[model samples]
Target: MEEYKKRIIKAIQYIDNNLDAELSLEKVAEIAAYSPFHFHRIFRLIVGETLQNYIIRKRIEKSAFYLALRKNLSIKDIYHQFGFSNHSGFNKTFKKYYGKSPSEFRKLAPENFHKIQAKQSKNGQIDTVFDQYICNIENLLNWTNMHLKIKVTALPEMNLAAVMSLGIANVESSFNTLVDWAKTENLFPGENVKMISVYHDSFKVTPPDKVRIHACMLLDEPLKRQQGEVFPEIIEAGKFIIGSGEVTLSDFEQCWVSLFLWMKENNYSVRKAFPFEIYHTNFKEHPEGKMAVDFCIPIN
Candidate 1:
């Protein structure tokens, strides 16, 4: 990755880890090693939103996560945890984006946890990934054909050369670029190179418009950046329930819905962390033009 993207990601990670705290633009910019003015423009260009907006959205989303999953937490606990000044302000913002008050959303969310019907209004849009995933998951529960060999296991740590893109539409193009860069660098020391799409946000909770997809190639070891938008990132080892099977492109959403259903049935709680898809064989290379993939979901 270029120096700028690397720095921006550093800043973003910091923000994500500290959403409850006050995030001054100057401090965030300093973390990115850029001036506030320069950082503001770059953040908007790359992340598709102003720094403050990003922070606020993350805070609201985090609050929603607590409200939906951590029922032990009260409304005040959720809002205060995210640094809201008062219940009124939090309610105002939550209603704007979710098209419903926090209390009402909480009441409706239990029957369909991770299936909240956030508004798609352009004036108050959900993140792009959330929208795409919502469309993918229409009638998801009705899907009973999903099947695969799935179990929780430890995934070994991996270091990858990654390229990020927004939306599902652009993922293929970005991944192709990363693949070309990796091949040119002769970094494929082993026959098997892991192709991964690392998801930063869960669609179930996040509103649509901004979806982060990092197309990555597993590297044997870290190598200096030579070219392209490739940057280094580490996926820590964790317990993830993985379902492996062949899925047609059209059935992709069904597969995920089925996996989540299975996870719920087996008494696994989803965590706020990265989940991923591992491609065993290229879809284009498959005999039936299907992707031999492993759908992995993080669990607590």
Candidate 2:
């Protein structure tokens, strides 16, 4: 298990460093010193998805966040940043996951972007109410020596209804269940919607079977509270280190370890809540080989 863990970490680092270059599962497995056949199975058993699915999800998720926050960037520029060889390929992938063209998602931001009003406590200290920590890669111990450039940012409060899973959560299945329930209940308003997973355990110490996850949403209106169900709650706003790239499930530990190393080295502290994952792409529409999710790590 320890040996597998090391190989997984190396694979994640390779993916992070080569996002803009051509990457193949077989090649990535080679880097991990595993045969493609066994590697693919192990990766899925650990990560819950195939290698290609993980990569596509990370690339698209990264592009989506930039599209939302960096309005000045062009679609073409975003595509190049993720290593799409041409505009057509990027558009197809983007539309498949997001349910809209990049231009469409950008256009919705003006009206749909939820502007969070910064809150202050009467004590005069910047109400650490949603105090968030942001860590850049320069401070990370594991990747500090690597040449990657990374940044961290603070995110505003969001409203969501979530289903809590106490043990190893089948995230893909749980997300589908939530969406189906939301659709049946009209939770999605056709404006942009976000799917988030709040993590309650340190990925490092928590066994995959013992991890907890909350499937949540970013909503504007109050949801009809359900009996025996967790209600919509405000995720206190905070700082987060937002990073993107693909990694197999087996490699998830390395990705998280790298993030935590960044936090510790940067003098930032982790919030007690579990980290949340945002799905920027529509998985149902994308080919199974291509899917993306964005990870948001809350900081203090």
The segments of candidate 2 whose C-alpha lies over 4 angstroms from its true place after superposition are 1-149, 188-191, 227-230, 246-251, 282-290
Model 2 has an lDDT value of 0.60
Instruction: Point out the worst 10-residue segment of candidate 2 by lDDT.
Output: 125-134
lDDT of each residue in 1-300, candidate 1, tens digit only = 357766787788789788778899999999999999999999888777899989988888777766766666799988988889899999999876676688987886654654454556556564212223343333554453344677799888888888876556678988987877877788653478779888875556564456667888887887465354777877787889898888777766667667776776677776667778888777787788898888888777
Q: What is the lDDT, from 0 to 100, of the residue 230 in candidate 1?
A: 77
User: On residues 57-155, what C-alpha lDDT tens digit does candidate 2 reach at each position?
Assistant: 557755665565455678888889888888888888876665567788677533232221123346542211212223333443444335223368877
State the displacement of the C-alpha of residue 185, model 1, in Å, after optimal TM-score superposition. 2.8
C-alpha lDDT score of every prediction, in listed order: 0.75, 0.60
Assess every candidate by TM-score.
Answer: 0.82, 0.46
